[model samples]
Target: MRKCLSALLAALAFIPGCAPEGTGDLDVQWTVGLTGSCAQANLGFVAARLETLSGTLLARRDAPCDAHAVRFRDLPVGSYRVRLSAFDGDGVEAYAATVSDLSVQEGIEAASCLARLTPRPGTISLSWYFQGGRLCSAYGVEDVLLSLFSADIEILAQSFRCDRGAAVLEGLLPGSYEVRLDAVDAWGVPSHSFAAGNLLLRPGHELSFDAELTPCQGPCW
Candidate 1:
């Protein structure tokens, strides 16, 4: 009888005394824009990861970018970190952003998370000139229209009223670009045209180019 009682006591000790507290829910939404020049159709997935304050991963959820939201349920009440990422159709990460010190409470929902992401950028400085002095001196070609294009012929950036014979294009992604400039007369009509192509820009790098315009005798098309 004594041996049986001791064995029963040992077995009861191994069992848990009480159930764990109920978990909470975490809802996250990205309020900011994504990085890269890819189209939305190329974006394959959006992912969110929850981790403890000490960097212990707790849960992860992935959904389509068009799903509009992400939720992690049954999370213990504590502080955590959330990371968000957008992946392309080829499984390549196009953009990533994170939020820290998120608090979750028992039986309560924690929402209102916002993450902002920015792509790597480069710079382009362009200066314009005319082959004949008549375009600038006689016609007074002070206002110019400038357009920047990607290698695939996509319009990446543009500017109007570019004065001082110079224009600066900023926050451009690293790639090959082409420059197109049109001189505007007092009546806002295009009088001259110039083009510079195959300019390479790297991340955090600056590129400078010169555009020499020729007078349009007939119609500036």
Candidate 2:
């Protein structure tokens, strides 16, 4: 799903006192970059991480998407960075930002800000046809199942009517994927198949795949 945009500007501030010995406290507030709200962009939550200046992770948490301020209490005094990421309903990152060079002092409150996250994700549109025709009647096929594989693991599976011939997948991570298509007959038997390997997906772009499915000879017969 493609969404519209709204700019969210984050702010940074620091206050003195109210911390335990040899430690500090942190508070973070942020909002989604695009659309009216996170819900409008189909984003559920924000992934927040506290890390050292040298890339050592300190603490991480998931915050609400509604611009709620999250509290990180009792942090060791040090210099660190804060990273924020918001994900879509399917756990795909839809918004992200990294803020660095934060210095936390003992017995003080560190307030942080974040840069605007660009809404960037990929989409895949697939269309399939049988050797005989586009109608799928000649092959007795009633359904086509589409499965997407990432790193040799099945990430998604969806079924569509054979006659439909096309479907669109959205909010995909940028990477290499394998697309598998199976045509099933009236009795739920697989009658034809097609596969395309190493399909590349880029950020903020749409990839299209059109393929012809051959009859399952020895296996189906």
TM-score of each predicted structure versus truth: 0.44, 0.49
lDDT of 1 by residue, 139-186 (tens): 666578777788657575454554577877887786788887788877
Clashing pairs in 2: 5-35
- Among all candidates shown, the one with the greatest lDDT: 2
Q: What is the C-alpha lDDT of each candidate?
A: 0.68, 0.75
Which stretches in model 2 have alpha-carbon errors above 4 Å? 1-119
TM-score of 1: 0.44
lDDT for 193 (candidate 2): 92
Q: Candidate 1: deviation at residue 4, Å?
A: 52
Please give, for residues 67-146, the per-residue lDDT of candidate 2 as tens digits.
64576787765556788887777777767778776655576556455456556778999889877679898888899988
Kindly give the stretch of ten consecutive residues in candidate 1 with the minimal lDDT sum: 32-41
